[model samples]
Target: MLHDLGGLLFIALGLVLVAAGFVWQGGALRPLSTKRAQAAAMRDRSRNLLRSADMAIAEARRRAARDEPAIVTVEDVTRVACRHYGHLFVEREEAAAALRQRYEAADCRVDCMTDAFN
Candidate 1:
């Protein structure tokens, strides 16, 4: 009977340790999941900015084709993106910087360093 009791006590301790290990693992994974979510959000923001800049470029091209005084310049991509996604940025400078990066990638004529908006 004593031997049986000893075995049961060992089993109980083993089970407790296993449960603790699971809890620790769960805690560790939580931060990883949070970081993944943050990265996903950042990617989505970048995609949206790029799409907006592309659309602005296309609109400018269409106007030039029609010989209509181009209402939107390549530099205006930043302004257009900011108008749509302004809330995503913490500051005007941040919005300008992000939009300008996207605009340059989309082949805007103005250099990122010189263009105030694009």
Candidate 2:
């Protein structure tokens, strides 16, 4: 009788361990998926920013070539760059806001602490 009880206890303990493992894995996987999605999104955003910057530079060069003004100043290039960057900033802000909303919904943390540090 005692042997049978020991076997039953062992079986119960094994079942509990298996259940705990599944629960732990499920919890861990949720965060990993969120992180992977965030990373992919960030990469896509960076690629878009780079493409926009390249196009803006090309357009500026084309404009300058066509205009052929008497004086081509650094300010001219800077003005065009600022305009390009401003548009990019607006788009990036919108994307970031959307991501933040998603993260909040998932109960995940968004690391915007850099703004505070700066």
For this target, which candidate reaches the highest lDDT against the unseen true structure?
1
Candidate 2 has its poorest 10 consecutive residues by lDDT at 109-118
Model 1 Cα displacement at 42 (Å)? 1.1
Q: For each candidate, what is the lDDT?
A: 0.61, 0.46
What does the lDDT read for residue 34 in candidate 1?
75
* Per-residue C-alpha lDDT of model 1 across residues 1-118, encoded as one tens digit per residue: 9999999999999999999988787564435587899999888777766676567656666656443433444346556666776733434464456556655675555422234363
lDDT of 2 by residue, 72-103 (tens): 22233334434655533434343344333433
| TM-scores of all candidate predictions against the true structure | 0.42, 0.32
Runs of candidate 2 with Cα error greater than 4 angstroms are: 1-32, 66-118
RMSD of each: 8.4, 16.3
